[model samples]
Target: MRTQEGDKTVELFLSDEGDEVVIEVADQGCGVPEALREKIFEQGVSTRTDEPGEHGIGLYLIASYVGRCGGVITLEDNDPCGTLFSLFLPKVKKNDDRTINPIDR
Candidate 1:
């Protein structure tokens, strides 16, 4: 981690974008390495090595769920440090029959 606990902030932003919703989570920790950026979402891939049993499947699972829901997730470097995760999901709408439908892109 770049900043010690309580020294940095993790920010989240949400906004409505027409048919979709944008969600962003930005942290002020050690930024992800360039070499691992492309494969960060793959299972068994992770940056933290200090933990005894860190599986690194968290992001992979998240990606899987997002894909199934017809949403998209992306990882990027934060402003000065840390990592930023952005998720764009389709908005839910109610049909005339009262059924719930999540917009598909």
Candidate 2:
């Protein structure tokens, strides 16, 4: 992870394990409070106004879309401070019968 400005840092990781691929985005900012952790994915829920045009839909949309793709999303504490978002996506191998219909969405 590399620090950007101030004490902020962002990190991304990707790995493949078994039948799924994992993606993690970690940030060293004000960590999500324990009280609001479960409600963070709700629409219009936000804690920080530091970023420009942060509509608070990123998590909500991520959860929604990941769910539609039969994947899982999780959040974890990033040690001293910050949050880690982990996304697990099931691989769709070639000739796989599982079809993802985006138009029906």
Candidate 3:
């Protein structure tokens, strides 16, 4: 969904979900299409065409980093308009001797 400049807004939310941290970014812009929703995080996939040779890779890198941190990423539709990107990242828990690795959990 395309929104007017006045309607453009980006909202961020961070929440503690027990063992994971929830990070959500919602933007009021041209939302991701249903057809591209699933592949939005894949490499070489992008909706922005205003720039030449500068498409994709962003979400791919984000997904890769999130995965390496033992986290998961999700895409959803924002209310009214736009796309919502959410990342559930594992919290770094510390033990008595040292900090525990998120991946080891």
Candidate 4:
């Protein structure tokens, strides 16, 4: 929740959509510029100008793991402020799995 007097906060939500698990992590911090959005996923592209040990490889690690799991990851601008990282992972099924597996694109 957001209020006019308070600062933006962090939020996380997990949901199941048909056969995929949708994961969303959002924050109310300064938003990422459109030009640097994809670049942030690359190493040595840190948004933290004031902090040390700022290697922009955290997202890259997550993305690599997600890729190995056959999942799709995306980043988008969050309303009001902040960035949204959304992941759609294939639902693991036991016995007989019926959902279509996500293809890496």
Model 4: residues with Cα > 4 Å off, grouped in runs: 1-8, 95-105
lDDT computed for candidate 2: 0.83
Q: List the residue pairs that clash in candidate 1.
A: 2-30
Tens-digit per-residue lDDT, 1-105, candidate 3: 335566466889999999999999999787888988889888889988676887888898888779887799999888888889999998875653433244331
Error of 3 at 53 (Å): 3.3
Winner of 3 and 4 under TM-score? 3
Please give the TM-score that candidate 4 achieves against the real structure.
0.75
Tally clashes: model 1: 1
Q: Would you give me the overall lDDT of model 4? A: 0.79
* Candidate achieving higher lDDT, 1 or 4: 1
lDDT of 1 by residue, 7-72 (tens): 788899999999889999998887779998999888889888776886778888888777766799
Model 2 superposed RMSD (Cα): 3.2
Superposed on all Cα atoms, the candidates' RMSDs to the truth, in angstroms, are 5.1, 3.2, 5.2, 6.0
Tens-digit per-residue lDDT, 4-104, candidate 2: 54657789999999999999999887888888789888877776666677666778888877887899999999988889999999998888887755524
lDDT of 3: 0.83
Q: Candidate 1 versus the native: TM-score? A: 0.79
lDDT, candidate 1, residue 95? 57
Candidates' C-alpha lDDT = 0.82, 0.83, 0.83, 0.79
